[model samples]
Target: MSGAQRETTEYAVPAGVLGLKGPVEKPAPGTLPLRGDLAHIALAGSHLAAHYVIPHVRTVGTEGAGLRLAPRADGEIFATLPAGSRFELLDVAGEWVWGCPGPQGPTGWCRASDLASAES
Candidate 1:
């Protein structure tokens, strides 16, 4: 091995455990959290899990900010966020960003331009 260190995590369930809702996660760039059905999963060469993301919350910038099921204008609109509304930003793809209304609230994609950093 080179001077760089590689950390490997083990995922083994205890004996007699059953009825797991999701699969165990492999190493990821960030931490994985498990809640209901939402997950920050990537499958290039590993698996991942999901959970409530109350820490990475962001603000809805300007008026007419919309939270949609997909990251497109034609995506279904679930809610119209007011200026300064806070939501947990989950992922990003091009001009779109995935997020939820709150830690345990509904999740969807929103236009990245409509979102502002919470500290901004």
Candidate 2:
């Protein structure tokens, strides 16, 4: 290989962050295996992460609210779902709603404020 280093043009969202840890969800019988980096975010040349369509979205919030493993403010931070992040509605009680990244996502509870919706 020739010694050549060229920096790629930067986009709104870095391409490296678009990949997944594993498959978004499991494949059915006889289904083809999926590649690791399937999830793509739009950049300026493309677009930004528009949405995260979950099962049922009631209300969408911002990072100021913060995502947590539990509904409480002091709960463990599972993942940082930035503004407009889609979440699947699982369970809701009072002011807290349980959710996941998607249908087959690891379930957790986020503060009602952090969620798009706290309703069932």
Candidate 3:
């Protein structure tokens, strides 16, 4: 998506609760399987996502995988998923898959090659 479109698609965390002023704090970037436009269905009511999804569960490969902040090799690695770890798969782009280790997560990008179907 274009930069402008991306900006427009982002969902802001809601401000205030019980008459407060500041925005409702969101969890750390990789700690919730939520982007401005999409979130895990389980987060409904707690977050606003343009669309909510039910993730497809996958398993980390024997070599394991690093969850990166961005969908590039050079992206920062925030979490290291051990082999056989369960991954909640959300979106995929090229060789990268965007997802979390679970509903409560350190969500980020992982190489598609690093994951296998649950049965694998």
Clashes of each: 3, 5, 1
Worst 10 residues of 2 by lDDT: 30-39
Give the candidate number with the greatest lDDT: 3
Q: Give per-residue CA lDDT, model 3, range 1-120, as digits (tens).
A: 344321221232333322434466777788899999899866765766689887888899999999998999998888899999888899999999999887788899999999975563
Candidates in order have lDDT scores of: 0.55, 0.47, 0.81
Q: Put down candidate 2 lDDT per residue, 43-98, tens digits, no spaces.
A: 12222233422145444575523455546778776556567766655456788866
Stretches of candidate 1 exceeding 4 Å from the true structure: 1-55, 117-120
Off by over 4 Å in 3: 1-23, 117-120
Worst 10 residues of 1 by lDDT: 40-49
Quote model 3's TM-score: 0.77
> Best to worst by lDDT, what's the order?
3, 1, 2
Flag regions of model 2 displaced more than 4 Å. 1-54, 117-120
The positional error of residue 15 in candidate 3, measured at the CA in angstroms, is 24
- The residue-by-residue lDDT of candidate 1 on 1-120, one tens digit each, is 557654432222333343444666443222232224444321212333343222466778876477776577887786677888875676778999876655334556778888775463
Q: What is the TM-score of each candidate against the true structure?
A: 0.53, 0.43, 0.77
